[model samples]
Target: MAKQHKIIHVDMDAFFASVEQRDHPEYQGKPLIVGGQPDSRGVVAACSYEARQFGIHSAMPCARAYRLCPQAIFVRPRFEAYREVSGQIRDIFWRYASEVEPLSLDEAYLDVSYTADYNGSATLIAKAIKRDILKETRLTASAGVSYNKFLAKIASDMDKPNGLYVIRPERGEKFVETLPVGKFHGIGPATEAKMKQLGIETGLDLRNKTLAQLTERFGKAGHYYFNIARAIDERPVRSSRTRKSLGKETTFAQDITSVTELTTKLLDLAEIVLESLAKQKLNARTVTVKVKYSDFQQITRAHTLDHSIALGDLREVIPMLLARTEAGKNPVRLVGLSLSGFDAGKSEDRQSQLDLAFSDPF
Candidate 1:
């Protein structure tokens, strides 16, 4: 007999803005914007619930957000604090089940089918977890209990800001039929518009189309859409997975064309790569440098180190990589640095070296 599946989705409500309000008593009850500086060419990272009432949201231009809420308080983001809180939240999830898949800093899915205390039911477990978060973090969380990740994630959003919802296996298909297409995860604005054009505005409309029709229209994604339309998601909740590669890339605001300036940008990119590696406990044996010209043409140059590479080594190697470039070329528009071929053990050894290098040997 097939085992009854048990999954829970937990999402923090307005995570970034809520964190800001929690730390700053003065920012409470007033509209607050957290992102880039308003004076600079910055975008809104997040805004408080009050700011949402004024149509301020993430990815909106800071200038536009300011215009919408003239008296809004704007502050720079504290990512370190957010990371700390995220760790705490994940630790809380661990008490319930070890099979937790973190989607981001503020959301995760847990499979508790084989839990030590399965007698209580998934819904009860979710409610207990939410209450625990509020008690420990002084923050609110919304939880959804269901038989699969897709339905659980959708149910989690049904109730927001300290909400608890459940999707029973028997009612799953009916619940999905009434759901709007836009509400489905991975169907962003562009896909939603296309779905609307095909008269697929609701899950029911999506179910009406044959799988072949969906595949013809949406390609591989069409298959996923068809399954989701029927509320049948069999994907497992993955807890730990090996990372294939580590890299970072950025698009320039404007094209740049100078080796000296490009070198400077490479330094910054290397630092970002190093910090990410440090957090992930990874060290790379291969360093790849990416260059993009004004015309959007791109090329990559890579160097393999004899031993695991360090950030300082990357700083020294990047300029040499740039020097190998053909002398007579246009100014580069963007520069990126990537470290791949990570050795988990090498990362720990390198971290020890770093610690010793900075230590005061008396």
Candidate 2:
């Protein structure tokens, strides 16, 4: 007899806002917003469930969010602080599974099929982890348990803000068939609208379409949709994935035409990219500079480094890359800096280093 596969998806609910509330008791039970400043042409990063009552959501303009919930507490995001909490939660995950794939700062998938203790079932493990997270971080996490990645991800979201849902292998297919297409992870607003236009509004609608039909309409994505509708997912929880690229791009409040102004923007972009690389503990062998002109024309320039270069190195290189461009011909609307071709270190390597260095020796 083959062994059953047990996959778990963990997601932090309203991560940023929840973290802010947890750290500041005064903000508890209030409509808290974590994002950029309202006056700085910023957007809401995340809003408490309370704020959602006013129809506020992530990426909504801060000004609009403020107008909707004028009494809501708006605060800028602190990535470093969030990263600290994330690390603590990750450590808790490591205690249960060796194979953990973090989807973002606030979510991850874990494969515990090869557990050393083999005590209890997957649901028990999920429950225990959630309890530990709440006890340790004073934060809530939702857990989804299932036989495959797709089902596990969906199950986890079935209930939110410290909820847990499970889909056993025998019932996985039935569960998936009844799910709405809009509930699927990759089906965005655009895709859902297109699916509706085709008279396809549910998983059953998607399942009714032949692979050829779906592929014709959605290209490669169509095939993926078909497979997911059937609850067929083969992706594994990968723990060794590394940072693929480091990049920064900025949209301007106003466009600039002068070479000197473009150079200044490029320099700023280089610094931002460098800071990201340092945080990720990565060095890149390739440098890519991208520019979008006010006319919406886009161009890119790339240069390979003889050795892995640091952010400081990029500060010097980006100006040279900008100088090489024909700047006077077009006014620049956006500038971006990207670094690819990372070395062997894994994505969490730098984070682990920081954790180790900061721990007390007593």
Candidate 3:
């Protein structure tokens, strides 16, 4: 058998909120939130562990978060500060592992399979990295070491807030058996519900389903589910992965009923997206419009052209896309626009782009 690869996943504990606390000593151990004001139409970007006790989490509406804990402290995000810390943390990752794959500002995967350090022990490297992060950044981080990305990422979350967990290669397959399908890394809430409807609640339940049965129900993703259920993921840790899409969305505090008003909002969003695209020197061929009704019904309509879409093109295309939705007949609670099918030659410029979260279901 081929040698198993060693991977370590590291995630900062309550990153943004922790940063706020670290900078402002008065905010320490308080119910701190980093996002919009309670009165604004903004959502919680990140909250301290103290805020989580009051049932506040990222993507929750700031107004609702206030209702949960009226005493919670809310502050606007300082991306510059976060980016600086993220860069520092990445520098530490390079000290131990040459192959680093950053998932976000606060989390990354490091492949140490070929490294001769620590007697080729990934667990020791993970521990040392965690120690270095705490010493250098003064922030706690959780680490998970395993043979593949799936298990490594999952192990990292099993023990949190300065945790270090390892899943041995021998126990990798058995470890997934008892986990709920919803707990799987890639399975979202919608997919979890679908899996439950099919009487697949845990990894064992998913593993019992034949490949044909899975593909018939889940299409292409069925193959992925099947392999993950068996803990047989073979995906390599790519140091350079291209981002697929970048866009912006806004959730309204009040529903919008006028198609004209909706069109105006789309234009504003398009301007921001197009500006980012231009700054990145990227071209997009597909435009997607998302509409969420007041009753929580969401729909997306997309149009693709052979040529890159310009602002002038979107001025004409936005109305046609809105016409396909029930914006006038029904109230729209959220509206978003995304540009995809980026020119293959260009990779995403992370520093120049900010992809906000769409309306969160939870």
Winning candidate number (lDDT): 3
Clashes of each: 1, 0, 0
Candidate 1 per-residue lDDT over residues 1-362, each given as its tens digit: 45667899999988888888976788899999999877768999888889999998899999888888889999999997788568657756765653789999999998766554435377777877887677546679999888889999998999887899998888889998999999998689999999999999899999999999999989999999999999989899998754545555554655776677777778887786677567545668898888867664667888989888887788788888887764127767556677888775565654554343211100
**Across residues 1-362, which tens digit of lDDT does each residue of candidate 3 receive?**
46668889999999999999976889999999999999999999999999999999999999999999999999999998799678668766755664789999999999777655576688888898898777656789999999899999999999988999999888988998999999999999999999999999999999999999999999999999999999988887777644445566666767999999999999998997787577556789999998989886789999998899999999999999999998899999778788889887443453222232212110
| Candidate 1 clash figure, as a count | 1
Kindly report which residue pairs in candidate 1 clash with one another. 257-331
Please state the error at residue 31 of candidate 2 in Å: 0.4
TM-score of each: 0.66, 0.66, 0.67
lDDT value, residue 246 of candidate 2? 58
lDDT of 2 by residue, 3-111 (tens): 4668899999999999899767898889989987767689999999899989999999999998998899999898987996786687667556647899999999987
Model 2 TM-score? Answer: 0.66
lDDT, candidates in the order shown? 0.79, 0.79, 0.85
Q: Highest TM-score among the candidates is held by which one?
A: 3
Residue 306's lDDT within candidate 1 is 85
